[model samples]
Structure formats: C-alpha cells, structure tokens
Target: MALRFEELDFQPTPMGEISLRRRYDPAARQDVYEVRLGDEYLMSSLFTAAERALATLALDVLDAGPDTGPDAGLRVLVGGLGLGYTAHAALADPRVAALDVVEYSAPVLDWHRRELLPDTAGLATDPRCRLVQDDFFRRMGAAPQDRYDAILLDIDHTPDHVLHPSHAAFYTADGLRNAAEHLTPDGVFALWSDDPPEPVFEATLDEVFAERASHPVRFGNPITGGESANTVYVARGRAAR
Candidate 1:
C-alpha cells in the first residue's frame, strides 16, 4: 500500500493562515483536495455531496419558477470557491448565464487558476464564471439592489459556527436583510451548513425573506463508513417595498 502524502500550498491572509492541499488516498484510489484555515479543516474533496447540493437545490427551485426560460440569462453569485464544486455545478445548468464567485483567499483562487486541484472543470477560464478575490459577506452587503438571481453561500462552517467573528452578524436578522437587498424579488439564497437543520436560523430566514426551505443532504462518509448529513438552507428574496 502506498503512503498518503499531501502537497500543501500555504498562505497568510488577513483572516488567518489558509492552506490548500492535495493528497492521494490509497483506499479511494484517487486524489483528494482539502482546504484548511490554520489548523481547522474547512473543506475536503472526499465529501462534496452537500457542496454540490448547494448549487443544485438552489437552481432547481429557481428553475421551477414560471418566469425562467431557455434564455432567461440567470445570474448567480457564489460566496465560496472550495474546489470549485459549487461554481462547476452552477455552470452545469444551461440556464445559468453568468456566475460570480467571491473567495477571500488569493491562494485558493490561484490553485484553481493553476489547475492544481484534481477537479477544476476549467472554472478559471470558463466563459460564464468569474472568480473575484473579495470577502463574500462584505460584497453581499455592498452589492447593488437586485443584482443577482441567486446567491449560494458556503464559506463558513455553519450559520451559528463561523470561521471569523465578523461573519457571525451575517446570520442575524439585520445581516440577512442586508444580504437579501442584493437579490431579485424572486431570487433564491441558498447556504450550506456543516450541521443539521437549525430552527432558530430558519426563523431568522423567515423573518428576512418571508419564505424559506431546508433540505438535509445525507451522504456516505468514506472515512467513517457511516452516513453523515448537512443542511442546505434556501430562501426567497423579499419584494422591495
């Protein structure tokens, strides 16, 4: 059996130290990519069901609308770029015309540009995708009104468990309201959570968006040989007064 070794690219950011690593798993017989913030494991290629679901579930609900057409030119904003799964999933849907991905880490963006990760699907060069080096929460707050048809967020661990202290506010009523301002009237906002459904967070979404849904995505945890689940929270933007 071959030993598992990781090729790491480390960088220092305002938030903290961010590391991108690629490792070969002898069990899976494939390469797995991972992202870490300091010593915290942020994301991994070994488990991406919920990450892909973040894009699929959001777009599926949006596509159900009567206003959506073959050439609707749907514009989407993805809040994270972990392995480009969300962005790649968004592009998989032909209805998506433009996708703007906001990632705070420059090295993560560079990994995609250099095609260092095992799966990029040409996300850096994709005609429909643009990778922006910016803070997702701040960008959402400052974006123009009705700027996006959908917003998919997966930056933090969860609504209650955030990587940065400043991000905690984004989960509150005021913060969500600010994020909602950037969405079209019928636009969708979907977020990925490491934890299961949280009712308190759901209530906040209801207060801000007026309508929301929670989907529990369950998948096999290869390392544990058991099932694990995550929550994908989707909400509709409230109409402007």
Candidate 2:
C-alpha cells in the first residue's frame, strides 16, 4: 500500500494562518482529515468522540419525557464547524429542526463547501444545517431573545485557554450572560473543552445559569492507547439575576 498526503487548502485569516490536510494513517488504518491554525492542531477526524458527545449530551437533556412528545423542531446554534462532527451529531437526532453553525473562518467553510472533507460535507447539503460566516461570540450577543433551544460550542481550546484574547470575555460572568440571552428559557448551553473539568469555569457557569453540569467524556486515544478525556460544560438558561 502507498501513503496518501495532501494539503487541501491553506489561507490567511483574521485569526492566523489556517490549513486543511488529508493523510492516511497506518495505525488507525483509515484516511484522516485535519485542520490546523498555524502550528496548532485545531481538529482531526480521527478523534471525534468528544465533539460528537458535545451535541448528544446537550440534546439528551432536552429530549422529551414520558408526558411530553419528542422535542421536535429543535433549533440549535453550533459555535464551530470543525470537521462538522458536532453539527452532524446534532442532526442525527430526528427532533432537530435546524442547526445554525457560526464559524469565523471563511477558509474553513470553503473547505466544507468544496468537499475537501467528504465525511463532513454532508452538512452543507443537510436541510437542517446552516453555515454562517461570523464571529460566534458576536452573533451570540446580537441574537434575539430565546432564539435557540441549545447552543453547542467548540471554538476555543477551553474556557481558560482561548485562541484569541477577545474570546476570554465569553467565559466571564458578563460574557456568559450575553450568550444566555440567545437561549430559550430552559434552553441548554454546552461547550467543548480540550482539557478536563475546571472548578473555576464551573463556578462561572453556576453564576450565570440556575442549573448546570460538567460532563467528562473519555475516549480511547489511538496514538497513546490510553483513555483521554474532554470536558463538556452544560448549563440551563434562566432569567438574568
């Protein structure tokens, strides 16, 4: 067998230089697609369990109970379009009526539009999904009241580790309050953190939402052959104090 390698696209964005590449991994015995921001590995197709969980875990909380029908026509806002795992996972649920994905990188969106990442390209054509080019944090602040049933984020590395300094505000008490405005009463807000659960961030969530939970999703690391975990912070939106 021969090795496969390709640099699908590369461009300079407001954030920095971004590149998309496709390579075949012998250990994983599969083709993998990756997106990078300069020297940082933004996302990979090989390890997507946590990204997918970000959607499922949040939506599950909104799932209908015995007395209620399915939470049909659910509207969701996904903060990142990395490889489309989260959006795809959200659309997997029959109840999801719409998924609005806000991505700050136009090149990233172009990659999906051109099908550079085949597995994730389906998102572009999915009737339930909409790809918007904009700053997620800004859009969240400008969003109308009760505009979304759930808001799923995977933009930054973590609440404390942000790619851009401006993003730090989103994790603060006031920043989170702006984001909460977009959520329906009882709406769900879930964020994907590359690191484990942090007490400080959890405390911030408690301050912003009436109810919240921190979920540690563990998955087998193909390269390490051991379990690695990511934190998914889920909070229920409530009227501002």
Candidate 3:
C-alpha cells in the first residue's frame, strides 16, 4: 500500500488560514472554489481597500450629526457580514447602541466563530448584536421595531455578478425605494460597488432619497497605478420630497 497524496480540496495561504483550488463547472461555466483565502482578501481580490473604506465612510456619515439625548441609542443595519471588518468598525464606535448583522451564508458565520476569522464571536455574542440568518429582503420585509441611523450593504462582488442574478434587484430603483422606506429620517444608505454604476442608477437614488452623493476612492497602486477607477455610492436617505 502506498500513501495517498491527492485527496485534499483546500490549501493554506500565508495571509489567512484557509485556501482552495478553484474548480470549473461546465454547467455553471463558473470557477469553483479552487482556492479561497479569507473573505477579507483574495489573491485575485483587488478591492480590499474599497470595501473597508466604504464601511469607514458609512460610519463617519452616520455619526456626523450633533449628539442628542444621553441615550439616543444608535442602531445600525449591516447587510452582509464579510470578514466582520465593517461590524468590527461599527462595534468600535461608542455611539452604536445595537448592531444587527444579516448574513445569508452559514459557512461564513461558522468561520467567524473561529479565531482566524477576525474573532467575530465577540460581536456575534454581544448582547447588543443580533445575527439574522435569512435573506436580506425577507428580513427587511418584516416590520422594523427600531429604525436605524444607517444602512450599509455589500452583498455582492459587483452589480454585474452572474453568480447571483437576484442580487441585481437588490440594487434596482424599486430596491432602493424599499430601502428608503426602512431608514430613519436623516439616515444614509451606503452601497459598495466595485465600480460606479451608470448615471441612471444615481437618478433612481435621487428619486427616493433627498440628498445624493457619490464618493470615488482609489486605494493601492498596482490596481489604480494605470488606467483604472473604482467608487462607492453614499446616498442620504431623505424623507419623501
């Protein structure tokens, strides 16, 4: 009998604890998980700077206004819990009264419990944190008990992703309209995109939100060293005009 040496599907990476060799599926015409590092970063992932920065900017916008009552109790709704960087940043803010993290994938949730996975258990287990394991839309459909000061979403790699077609609706005019319906007055809706969308989309946001603004942030040189551009959409959810 000889020792077996080819039965593994995942490998280890220097930056994170896990990695995998992607497999190609002819049916889906999509690459399987040949290799996957941390949700935070991937060798082929060039948007780390944008993702974290978007979270930071959203928090900044949420906390910009004058402080009110002693217990204003800031509440935040995070659409997707990636590596928990956004949640971690939110937890750092003392103003945040509660953090509602909605993640669709269970594997990602499991990983968060691990020490290598950014130690999200601290937030996950926090009394103020509520983990909802369901579709974002379904969760939103339920009447919200407490209106949030901010709603930050990063559900997909981009608006043009083929992996999840339904996600397209999540970024549509109607979708934004529903998002607006859920926000508290003066609250902002910040969406993360790999690249800026067409002007029509901004117009859609303006249709629902009062004040609209877009921020373009380029981080790291190799990606933006030559001819490249990336941005995030920061739209303040305004009351009906």
Candidate 4:
C-alpha cells in the first residue's frame, strides 16, 4: 500500500518522505519511517530520539576501550536497521572495521536501498557495511562464538514494548547468555530503549556483561532536542578468545 503522507504527521527530510500515525486503535498499528533519518517505530512510529540514542550509545561503547587495538579495527553487529541511523553512525567512525546490520523487514530494506541510498548518495553504503535481512534473535543464537566487537540493539521501543513475542526471549537472562557467547571479550552490547528498562531487564544485563551501564539521552530542547528521553544500555562482553 502506498503510504498516505497526507493523512499522517509529516516530517521533511533530505531523503524521500517520512510519516507518523498516532491514531491507531487497539487492534490497528502504524509504521513510522523517515525520509532521510530512519524507521523509528512500526506500530508506534515517530520516535526518532530512541533511534539516535541506539546508535550514539553503541559508538560510545566502542570508544571506551582499554584493550582495543591502536587501529581501532572492530567488528560491529547492529540488530535493527530501522532508518539506518545506527548504520550511518558506524560508517562515520574510523574505528569500525566491519559493520553487520541486520533488518527483518524486506520493504524497509528496499526502501532503504532504493530511496535512502540515492538520497544519502553512498554515504552509508560503504565497503564496511554488510546488511542482512533476518531475525535478530535467531541470528544471535546462530552467530559464531565470540565474533563481534559490538552488538547494538533497537529491535523494539523498549524491553517491555515487544512487537514480536519471540523477541522476548532475546531479553531473557538466557538470551543474554547467548549474546555473550557472540561477543569478543571487551566487545560492547548497546541496547536502546524508549524508557529505562524494567528491573529484571537491567539485572539480566548485569548478569551477562562484564561491565554494565545505562545512559539517558534527553530530547526536546531548543539548543539540543528532538523528541523524548531515550535510554541506552551499555554492556561489555568478555574478550574474544
């Protein structure tokens, strides 16, 4: 279905078009995507603040390295490719050796390849990017042992706001155990949430990562603002053996 930008909240971007629908009822849902930015939400679209924090926090984790090589060459795994904000940010960093961006939505991928690539013009399609269309939770379990330098997540609005029930497993203590197996000790796992996670979720991270921290990103200020107070969870994995 061709999106009806006229009927939704329109936000101008350097790319094609982005619209948000805030009127969905109990059963109906909405998808939010940006013209030049990213798809912040699907059913509850229009939360770009959360997306930006997801990317920024991942980068911050990468920068907090005592053991990172002098070259800063690191492999990164980003679990969601909503509007490519995380991908774009990773590409901007000279420290990133490779970026594996996984997105499950085919239309979202097409829109990105067709609309975003042309509009952004090769800024994000660098040689370092490897876009994979797959379920992040499944991939996490199947990924090789201790492989990635960083794992950035923005699969849902928050740990509580799950779009797919299967994803709940990814937030469980056991799921984080699997995620830890995929990290290269000292590798970072950055998770973006619309709000601070539940106590159980926070505990799960503490149980899995060697170091755990949460950073709050503020939005909606004249000088530095956009939407809401997004939170980023930073967790470090054991060094790759």
The candidate maximizing lDDT is 2
* Model 4: residues with Cα > 4 Å off, grouped in runs: 1-49, 63-72, 117-124, 143-146, 221-227, 238-241
Q: Compared with the true structure, what per-residue lDDT tens digits does model 3 show for residues 58-126?
A: 778765434676436677888877666667777777777777888776545655555334333576677
TM-scores, all candidates, are 0.92, 0.93, 0.71, 0.72
159-240: candidate 1 lDDT, tens digit per residue: 8789889999999988988888888788899999999899899988888886799999999887777899999999996734
Q: In model 1, how large is the Cα lDDT of residue 142?
A: 82
Order of quality (TM-score): 2, 1, 4, 3
Write down the lDDT that model 4 would get: 0.66
Candidate 3 Cα misplacement greater than 4 A, ranges: 1-47, 63-71, 119-121, 221-229, 239-241
Prediction 4 TM-score vs. true: 0.72
The alpha-carbon deviation from the true structure for residue 18 of candidate 1, after best TM-score superposition, in angstroms, is: 1.5
Residue 238 of model 4 has an lDDT of 46
Per-residue alpha-carbon lDDT of model 2 for 147-218, expressed as tens digits?
A: 788999999999878999988989998888888888877789999999989999998999899889999999
Q: How many clashes in each structure?
A: 0, 0, 9, 10
lDDT: worst 10-residue window of model 4? 20-29
Scored by TM-score, the top model is: 2
Candidate 3, residue 37: Cα displacement in angstroms equals: 11
Better by lDDT, candidate 3 or 2:
2
Better of 3 and 4 by lDDT: 4
Task: Give candidate 4's error at residue 84 in angstroms.
Answer: 0.8
